[model samples]
Structure formats: structure tokens, C-alpha cells
Target: MERTLSSELNTQQVSSKSAMPLRLLANLLQWQRRMASRHQLARLDSRLLADAGISEAQRFSELNKPFWR
Candidate 1:
């Protein structure tokens, strides 16, 4: 048995359509991680920031960013 050109195209189209929601979910999860990391940064004390080699100014800049950014 052999596949026809139309069947191949249909298979590709179905695969592409199904991937869209997965990509969206991955993007949303990435955004959530960024937001949580920023919140954690905001909670860090000066000593912990120093230990991590992050300056207060740098921490402020990252923590101040909008989650969407």
C-alpha cells in the first residue's frame, strides 16, 4: 500500500492544528514560572541577594517587571 499526496497533506494539517493548543499551554506555563520567580526575587533579603551575586538594584529591576514581559 502507498499514501497519496492528498492524504499526506491532510495528515500534516491535522498535526499542525493539534500542536497549537500544546504550544499555547507551554507558553502559559513559561509565563507562570517567570511570575513566580519574580515574586521569589522580591522576597529575598539583602544577604540572600548578595549570596546569589544579585545586587539590590538588579533584583528591583527584575521584580518590578510586569509578568507579561
Candidate 2:
């Protein structure tokens, strides 16, 4: 079997390595969205929270989570 530049570049290890930075960025964006939603949750009025079925304790727990989580 012979290897070509294109084939080598498409290998699992190389492709995974190439995607690492993009995946990290995507993960960070998702984390930021989660954190932002949590911040929004902290600002929700009692009526809205009740409508969303989120209790005060639940909202507090989510809002307290670290962005890395």
C-alpha cells in the first residue's frame, strides 16, 4: 500500500488534532451560552420562574455553577 499527502492528512490522528482547536472553541461557546442562560435565570421574576417550572433552589444551583462546568 502507498500513502499520499491527502490520505495522510485525512488520517484519524491528524484530523482529530486539527479539530482540537475548533472543538475547544465550540465547547467554550457552549459553556458561555450556558453561563449566560444561568445569569438570565438569576434575573427571572418569580412568575416567570414558576411558569418555567424552575424552583428558586434549582435556579440558584444552576446559577452557581462555574463556566468550566
Candidate 3:
């Protein structure tokens, strides 16, 4: 009975530890998606800037600013 309890506790600890990596993987995936979106937006912004006669350097400078502003 004692051994069984010990094994159960060990299993629980291992599962909890494994969950951390899964959470980290989820976070990494989320970050990757956000980065992809930002890249697409930057590409679109560059095109728009070109249409507006803005230089590439100026577009990059403006891109450094927050999107909401």
C-alpha cells in the first residue's frame, strides 16, 4: 500500500513537470503566430508607404513606432 501511494505521488509530480514544457510550447507557438502577423503587416505597410512616396528608411522608422498610435 505504501509503495503504491509513493508511485502515485511520483506519477503526479512527473505529470506536473511535463505540463510546464507543454505550456512553454503553447506560448512559443503563440509568439510565432504573432511574429508572422507582424511580418505580414510590415510587408503591407511597406507597400502602402511606397504608394505614399515615403522612402524605405522613413517607412522603417515609422514602423518602429506603435501600430495603435
- TM-scores of all models? 0.87, 0.78, 0.49
**What is the overall TM-score of model 1 with all chains considered together?**
0.87
Candidates in descending TM-score order: 1, 2, 3
Q: Pick the candidate with the highest TM-score.
A: 1
Q: Evaluated with lDDT, which candidate comes out highest? A: 1
What do the candidate models score in CA lDDT, each in turn? 0.92, 0.90, 0.72
Instruction: Residues 1-69, candidate 3: write the lDDT tens digits.
Output: 457888999999999999999998888887677666556646776667677787877656755754333
Candidate 2 residue 52 C-alpha distance from true site, Å: 0.7
Candidate 3: residue 64 lDDT (0-100): 72
Look at candidate 1 and give me any clashing residue pairs: none
Clashing pairs in 3: none
For model 3, the superposed segments whose C-alpha errors exceed 4 Å read: 1-7, 45-69
lDDT of 2 at 58: 92
| CA shift of 41, model 1, Å | 0.4
Q: Estimate the Cα RMSD of every predicted model relative to the unseen true structure.
A: 1.3, 3.2, 7.4
By TM-score, how accurate is candidate 2?
0.78
lDDT of 2 by residue, 22-59 (tens): 99999999998998888889899999999999999998
